[model samples]
Target: MVPTTITLHNTGNPLSPAANERGWLTNPANPRQASFHIVVDEREAIECIPLSENAWHAGDGSGSKSGNRTSIGVEICESGNYAKTLDNAVKLVAGMLKDRGWGVDRLRRHWDWSKKICPRLMYDDGKWTGWIDFKNRVNAELKGADNVKLDSEKVNVIVNGKKIKDGKLENGVTYVPLRAVGDALGATIGFDNKTKTATLDMKV
Candidate 1:
């Protein structure tokens, strides 16, 4: 799976970071057949499963065809300082979104996929607003829209060993049309005006 969405989860166990890491590594197929892409704590974010493969984390069931197969699952550890743990999760999620060119709208709570109240800290304490706030923070970290300026400057763009002249720099950030970049890189690019979204198709 290319991970079109990000799913948030909670470990629900008050285990040390190392203990949580060990659990995932040692039990690849637990009773629930549960697994996740990454486990995050106040100190670090540990990747247990490969992002290229889907993990059975969404709890939507084998035949449901849900987030377990389509989204990247990140379990936040609740055994430490909750604030620090959440900050780590935010950074990890922001990095994932930046790498994939995805927007905050792609974020999904585990609850969104299934009936499970996951990332429990954000759901149980009347703190659902925290999830929204997290998305907003991730969007701001992307720096694509909120940090750009109207003024344009000339910038050289090279794609597939060829120079492209349409690139521009605004507020010290380089900008290029998705279609132009995709074409130069031999990929199909599409835009959805209604959603203001760009889709890129690359041959793997």
Candidate 2:
């Protein structure tokens, strides 16, 4: 099924009775924890492990297909009661969504598809249950174009931070010209002397 929500859990122990410290156990043969594609250690500099197969972290009889099969399930091995882990979890999830071209709408908690109350922290309240807000946050960072505005004046040639040589801005400001700026930005600028045309390009 196409997932429409992303869930974050604090895998750390909690003092509250509602928040159980012990999590699910996996099979030794195919071990569930190893299936998680990326695991971030808040104590370190974002250590990550990429897995080709699914991790059985969800729950027993939960069927790997529902969550791990198509989900980039992440387990944060830090103190969940603190906000640092939660923030890091957000970053990790955002990066995954950007890499896979899946929006925040694709993020999901283990409990959403099964019997376990995975992503334990998120289950405390319904504040973060929805997808729209989370997706918006991810889209803003991934695209990096939402709030950024191109300076169309002052001979503006940069589009997405890359200087377009000799290319005129939409406002008709071809101030620095393409060849000069392109050459400065390490891009190749060409001049068609015969046709009186100039071309500046950079490989994406």
Task: Determine which window of 10 residues in candidate 1 has minimal summed lDDT.
Answer: 124-133
Please give each candidate's TM-score. Answer: 0.64, 0.47
| TM value for model 1 | 0.64
Off by over 4 Å in 2: 1-8, 14-35, 45-49, 60-64, 78-81, 126-136, 143-204
Q: Judge candidate 2 against the unseen true structure and give its global Cα lDDT, from 0 to 1.
A: 0.48
For each candidate, the alpha-carbon lDDT, in order, equals 0.75, 0.48
Estimate, for each residue in 1-204, the C-alpha lDDT of model 2 and write its tens digit. 343334444454443111122222333453444334445444332323244544444453455355645454566654433344444555667776776677756766666667466565444244332222334445567776333247643444565576553333445535453434654666655544346555666757
Q: Which stretches of candidate 1 lie over 4 Å from their true place?
A: 28-30, 63-65, 124-127, 144-204
lDDT value, residue 137 of candidate 2: 47
